[model samples]
Target: MKILSKNLIKLRDIKTFKFKKAMINYQHVEIVNHFMKKPLILVINCGSSSLKFSLMDPKTGEESLNGIAQCLLSDNANISFKVNGEKQVLALLPPFDHNTAIVELVNFITKNNLFEQITAIGHRVVHGGEKYHQPTLITPQVKNEIAKLAKLAPLHNPANLVGIEATEKVFSHLLQVAIFDTAFHQTMPEKAYIYGLPYNLYQEHGIRRYGFHGTSHYFVTQRASSLLQKPLEQCNFISAHLGNGCSISAIVNGKSVDTSLGFTPLEGVVMGTRSGDIDPSIIFYLVEQLGYSLDQVNTLLNKESGLLGISGISNDCRTIEEQLLAGNKRAKLAIDVFCYRIAKKIASFSASLDNLDGLIFTGGIGENSNTIRSLILNQLSLLGFKANEQLNEEIRFGKQGNINDTTSRPCWVIPTNEEWVIAEQTQHLLINKGM
Candidate 1:
């Protein structure tokens, strides 16, 4: 295998312009230009019908801007854009999807002069398949590559492309880049990603274990090495991102040698409403025995499953925990099943990584909910991981910190920063585009 250099590209002093001409901002300086050491970046993470954006300073590693467009297609579609901690809401017309939300977002930014110094725009694309393995400047070819992956992530990639297109229209002269959610795990070897199925199917259809949450995995790996004060090439860790969606990743020498999410986010550990790691036979069982259709079974696994289906209650981990405290048997069952699955997956990832340095918990459930963190680590005693209850409880809802003892493998609560990564990449690609 060819060895790729472990290079860290700094975005503070970068300026790139490709086919798109660079925006000429040589005259009037903005407030950001006064004491700025880092380039300003605009990042867009578009969901099925929602758009989440953030502004960041790559030099200072600070997230300095944020925006959210929720219920994008609803009658009450509105957007919340923030900067310097102050946020404003702008209501859009009826049936505003991601395509329209992005346009209005650009309008708001223009009216407020928010984009006065925005160097570039970065899009969080859900899947890049095996072709795009790094942050790519959005050109005709790059946009086509992202569009091809839409079949793999219909709910996400389409919306991502929409934002990319709309941004190109508005920020016509600025660099637009794509940072895929699957790029970080492009380091995985074929043996681990290949299923037991025939080789022809994979070769013909481009089907394999294409992991999700690459950005979250990337952030946690860096944080792990930082906490250990070890070079990333010498650090090894497992990252578990547990929210409405959950996936575990194994990091070896700063790369994702393996990951829990396979082919799609639906294949990982159980999530709020998504079934993770279910036997394929279950689908047949539901279809033949339960007389259910394939679409129904698909909905079963992707929606009406996991904690929601198991507990017969809400899928929110907090709600399920509250129900458990109220003596709900089904809720307790759901919580137990979720934690057990996470522990089991983490143990497997440890074997894949071998010589595990530590384990990290991010995402909503992983960062907060000390009970779940405690439960997960309790099952990990055999792996030399022990969390301090007091530390875990104290940081249940605070800034990122550690939860494990000093002598432990170095487990901690590192907050996931996909938006930050996106923003940084945006600034980098913008600066590099010209060169």
Candidate 2:
């Protein structure tokens, strides 16, 4: 393999307009710039069953278009989008796959002339192992490295690659970038990332912790630092990102000291379906004693457990809360367990830092669900973290504010912008390469 130098080009060497004129296909560049006064970056975040995308002005972080292609490869697969403020959903034909869905997206953008303004594309890859710590321009070499690292993230990286492949087919002329979710957590010390398994396994096979949801954690840390009037490098925080897939991060001096999700997204606080931090012996017990296959066990842990397993109704927190209020014991238990795990992780992560500057709540559940925030903070109130109930109640639906009393430690409800982070990284890489 040919080695690429770390600093191949510098941003100071060229201007963006001149770079665009020199690098991009002349006809497409003319059409792209003619329709927009600002260069737009397209960000893609792909999952097993969904594709989320956004078009944003990288310099201002202003979004122009955003949406998702959900329930892929299913009968109900659909594309939902909003452009310039109007929203619509289109039910795709049956047998819709990632490539077809991406093609549909491209058709819509081209039909509306939105594609002309897009300058570059950014993709979110979940795991990078040790190969990547920074966002990289997507080349053939980088794509091969991503495919090799899929062994460490079988579920996520594969789907991420699907998005990359699909996007490349439709937007061949624009530059593509890969932003690894594991890159930010590469700063974790050995003591935190190393597992208590055979030393040879870790050495030869890379069987160590590579935390997920790092993009969300890093974005919140930067936001929290700004809200607290402190430099990012001087901040210390415990960030709880609660959504379909949840994880908490302990950030020290702006770097991830530790995080909840492990080598995969499955090892974290209980998420919508994933089982987090369960006993390793359970797998053996199921396979050897109860007559289960390894694949079945994997499916159970990754898809059928967590709130869904416990509540026996739905995986959504909102649905669980509704059932709990209607006097369901299992729903209550699921919520209790979820809150307990988050509180426990917060306590443990606090010890990782000399002193906690503040706590940030983000992601879907963390930002919108006041009940979850109150429950988690109440568990930590004895340690000088108290939530202002009225304040918590008022902050929801993309609103951000401090939800803690003046006498207590700072607590913020900051909605995460993972797509924006990807765009920022993509733009920075382009600028550095003098493109």
Candidate 3:
């Protein structure tokens, strides 16, 4: 506890915090209680308009408390949380920002004395650019770097920094760690991540493929490697993270060799809102020939395209599936495009591997929607992935297990625990730094 006090004192002086010190892990070493053995790690992820948090046991992957502040900064802003097993919802009055939300959450934690045993806070930052490649202790300069990366990921990185800054003020004494979603993909080789554009654009603008959904892909890869009874460093597979925002990773020997998303997350397969892979010419055409501005073209590609764009309805797969059953042709077309694009990407990623060991499905649609899985697997029949009809039908609504038949390569529907990944990385860094 004395050492903890001394180390945290350095953080008190903002002017003295260096960039190099920000790269090092800051841990508070104190004799812990023998009665309650496990230390708690708080993981936080902020979307453009929502904040999700979890209090977890990093050693056991156990979550004691988890929740989300949804519809943030709006009239309908509310927090839905679970304590142990019981669930509760608290509505916040209008105009609640991240700072106000943090104040409320901190008060709740204090009322229950939850912060007394917390060892560290792990924040899920989306874009690290070329500056950060691993988890780092949060500092003022590190926060500024995160803010600067907002130019690359406007919808995500800035909002992530907000959560980090708010949590810093609330839990000022505890160590705060920033875990980048792009960190796991740092192992990707240049040949796989490079674009075919002008060399100067790549050198000067930092415009190269930086994949997203990395933590989820990494977690599911580890789980799949374990289930296959092979060492993680010896496993090869394709990981498809199917959610509102989706990406597929080609992991060879447990390292991400290639991924679907590029430069930004807008260059991959079709997502809920984003038009994943439209030609660059279309943007120029829209601006010059269709009388639209650059900003409007950007909005059309990122917000008005993909599933919603095709179906002329909701971006949700479930809703589209319902409409497909109701004989909606556009809805069927939307789903067909979604599944086909994923299948094509998975097939293409297999070319990057020497030999395929397995294929993993994760995230919301991958874990829950059996129909989507079947649609995708049916297109990959040439690759010997025969998803068992009964197994796919059985695993629904968060149930995870193998969904392949005897003659097929292993296909797993593992529910991803990205928060657990963040906590594990935080703990591993602490151990490596001899905290």
Candidate 4:
């Protein structure tokens, strides 16, 4: 009994010593983080089949890490990234999902000694409905609200929620903020958002046009304002975010007064697969005359239409452009329809503005495709837009500059920075909330 008691006392003493040492180590880590490390925000944007992440210094707008996990939940799932300008790729094993992807990302950050500097996590939520008008800190109620709004943005919100939940588990000690894509468009007026449906239906069902890609739009708007040397509130321009998914917004005094995307992303200009602005009667005709179930019709419109449907080739603009160069008639038709629709939408949005300052273009197609830009600009000659062929051709592949002639209004190719906007907003929210 005496020997056993002595051993127990020794065990207790050792535990106490270890505890004290751990506390000292923790204090040292805190001191180093405070003095040596700049607070970095980890921005996450999760799609249905992909997850994009970036570790950024919000103050300096410098990205330490940028990557995407593509083809999730499949055998070929892999992640490609650049850490401090060095590129690398890693394949994931089977049974990987968002949670697994996040864990791997956290492990990668820790391995590279960058985890200690990440002070918070920011999620790019696609829908905030009317509940969130700005960047909001995530809570249980907020999660529920985002989930509910998935009905409005099925392809986006649920994935965003999954990312948020997974990130919460992996970074339980860090603050998580949701920078919504719809939040910046909340400034839109009632007349601009209201539909022509019955008043009660809109009021009761919460069915109104809620714009998407607001983060991208807001980012380019700020850049345009800066380039034009005008205050944000004084800048009036039409910003087009053209990619696989397209939306155009009319910015009056830096606020979105009207936008092409309506209650859903499918209501705007033609997208990769979505049939934007189809006659409602066509849906009824497909159902009653063509023998299509509602689900099948939904799939057809959202997944099998647009450039792919018109070209009968591929949804990718680059591929379509190549085919057009090869004198493919269907490809020409697809390009013509795409450019005409966008140009028509831009002209319509001009009615919402008193004086057009300039035109801004950003996104995948907008930034890279000078051919499409020139084609669209040619259609807008009446609006005083004359594309400088040399300048337009030069300002692509991560280049940003005016692509307009000296006598015409400015047309810019500002690369959109949605991730930076998310990071900066997350930092600002933390500072405001004293977190």
How accurate locally, in lDDT, is each candidate? 0.80, 0.87, 0.86, 0.88
Instruction: Estimate, for each residue in 389-424, the C-alpha lDDT of model 2 and write its tens digit.
Output: 999999999999899988889999999998899999
Per-model TM-score on C-alpha atoms:
0.90, 0.91, 0.92, 0.92
The per-residue C-alpha lDDT of model 3 at residue 417 equals 96
lDDT of 3 by residue, 1-435 (tens): 565545444433333222233422433334432224668889999887898998889988998789888899889999877987888899989888887777766656655556555678899999998778888988889998998899999989989998988887666656789999898898899998889989888798888999988899999999998898899999999999999899999998899999998888898999999999988898888988999998898898888999999999889999999999999999999999999999999999877989999899999999999999999999999999998999999988878789998899999999999999999888787668756
Q: What is the Cα-based lDDT of residue 353 in candidate 1?
A: 69
lDDT of 4 by residue, 1-435 (tens): 454344323323321122232222333434434654587899999998889999999987799999999899999999888986889999878777887888788778766767657778999999899889989999999999999999889989999998998887666556799999898889899999999999997878889999999999999999999999999999999999999999999999999998999898899899888999988999999999999999999999999999999999999999999999999999999999999999999999978999999999999999999999999999999999999999999999999999999988999999999999999999899879766
The weakest ten consecutive residues by lDDT in model 2 span 1-10
What RMSD, rounded to one decimal, does every model reach?
Answer: 7.3, 6.8, 4.6, 6.3
Pairs of colliding residues, candidate 1: 15-431, 16-430, 16-431, 16-433, 16-434, 17-433, 17-434
**Which run of 10 residues does model 1 get worst, by summed lDDT?**
1-10
Clashing pairs in 2: none
Best by lDDT: 4
Model 3 local distance difference test score: 0.86
Residue 142's C-alpha lDDT in candidate 2?
91
- 1 or 4, greater by TM-score: 4
Model 2, position 183, has a per-residue lDDT of 96
Number of backbone clashes in candidate 4 = 0
Instruction: Please state the error at residue 97 of candidate 3 in Å.
Output: 1.1
Off by over 4 Å in 4: 1-33
